[model samples]
Target: MDFLPPLPLLIAFCGASVLLAVTPGPAVFYIITRSLAQGRRAGLASVAGVALGNLGNALGAALGLAALFAISSIAFTVVKYAGAAYLIYLGIKALRRPAEVRDAALGTADTRRIFRDGFLVALLNPKTAIFFAAFLPQFMSAHGSVVGQSLLLGATFVAIAALTDTIYATAAGTIAPRLRGNKRAGAAGRYVTASAFIGLGLFTALSGSSRAK
Candidate 1:
C-alpha cells in the first residue's frame, strides 16, 4: 500500500497510459489489422497475446530496474536521462516518418496462430521494455519500495493498454476504414503522438533536474 503511487500520480499514470495506448503503434496496428482482416475474435485474441507480451516486458523491466537503482544512484540517474533521450528520439522519428501499419496479410483466420504472432511481435520488440523502464519511473515516489511501485505501475499500464487495444480491435472497421492508405490521418496522428512523446521526455528530464537541485 505504501508502495502504491498517490491518487494524483496514479491518475496521471493512467492518463499517460491511455495516450500511449491510443497512439498508432505496432501492437495497435497488429490488433486493428487482425480485426479488419479476419474478424473480431481474431482481433481480441491478438489483443490478449499482445497484452501478455507487453506485461512480460513490464515485468522484466521492473525486476532489473530496482536492482539497478539500489546498486547506484548514479545508475539510476543515468537510466532516467537515457530513457528521456530515447523517448525524445522516438517522438522525433515519428514526426519525420509516416505512420506505418503492420502487414495485414501476415495473419490468418486461425485465431491461435494470430495470437502467437501477436505475442511474438510484442515480446520480440526490445523497445517495449525500454519504454516501460523509462516511462514508469517518472511517476514513482522516491520514498517507497521501488520494486513494489514498478510492479504495480507496470501492471496498471498493461491493463490500460489491453483495454484501449481491445477498443481499437473491435472498432477497427468503423474507425479506420483506410488506416493504411490514409496518409492524412496518419500525419495528424503522427504530430499528436510526436508532441506527446516530446513533451513527456522534456517533463521527465526537467523533473529529474529539479529533483537533483
Candidate 2:
C-alpha cells in the first residue's frame, strides 16, 4: 500500500526519463540506422529490444544486483571493458565497410535480427546499469518498499524511452530517403556513425564509476 511514489516525484521522473531518452546516444544512433535502412517495423522492434534491456538493468538495480556489480571492481571492470571493446569494434567495422556493402547489409537485415542486435548492445552496456542504479534511487522514498518503487521507476523510464525512441526512429525514417539519394550525404552519414561509435567507446572507457555511497 505504501509503495507508490509521490505524484510530483513520478512526474519529474517521467519528464527526466523522456528527456534522457531523446538525447542522442549509441542506442539512438543504432536505432536510427536500423530504421532508416530497414523500415519502421524493424526500428520499432529494435526499440522494444532496447526497452527490454533497460528493464533488465532496472530490475537489477531494484534487486541490488547493480550495487553488487558496482562494488565488485573485477566485475565492473569486465563489463566496462567489454562494452568499450564492442563499441570500438563496431566503429572499426563501420569505417571499414564499403558503402555498397553497408547498404546491402542494411537493406537485407531482418527485424528480429535488428531487435536482437539492439538488445545485446544495450545489455552489455555497463553505463546503462550504472545509470539506473544511480538515477532511480534518488526518487525513491525510504519509507516505501524499495523494490516496488524501483519497479515503478523502471516502468516509467521504459515508457518514456519507448515513446521518445519511436519519435526518433520515425523522424529518421522520414529523412533517410533524402540522405540515401545523395551520394555525398550518404558518405557523411557513414562517417558520422563511425565517429559516434568511437566517441562513445572512448567516453565509456574513460568514465569513472557512478557509484555513490
Per-residue lDDT of candidate 1, residues 90-191 (tens digit): 567646752233223223256776677667656644456667777889999888788789889989988988998888888864544454455565556556
lDDT (10s digit) by residue, model 2, range 103-159: 654445567766776676677776677788889878877889999999889878877
Clashing residue pairs, candidate 1?
none
Model 1 — TM-score against the truth?
0.61
| All models, RMSD in angstroms | 9.4, 3.3
* Cα lDDT, all candidates: 0.67, 0.74
For each predicted model, how many residue pairs clash, with residues at least 3 apart or on different chains? Answer: 0, 0
Q: For model 2, what is the error of residue 21's alpha carbon versus the real structure, in angstroms, after optimal superposition?
A: 3.0
Mark the regions of model 1 whose C-alpha exceeds 4 Å error after superposition. 65-108, 173-213
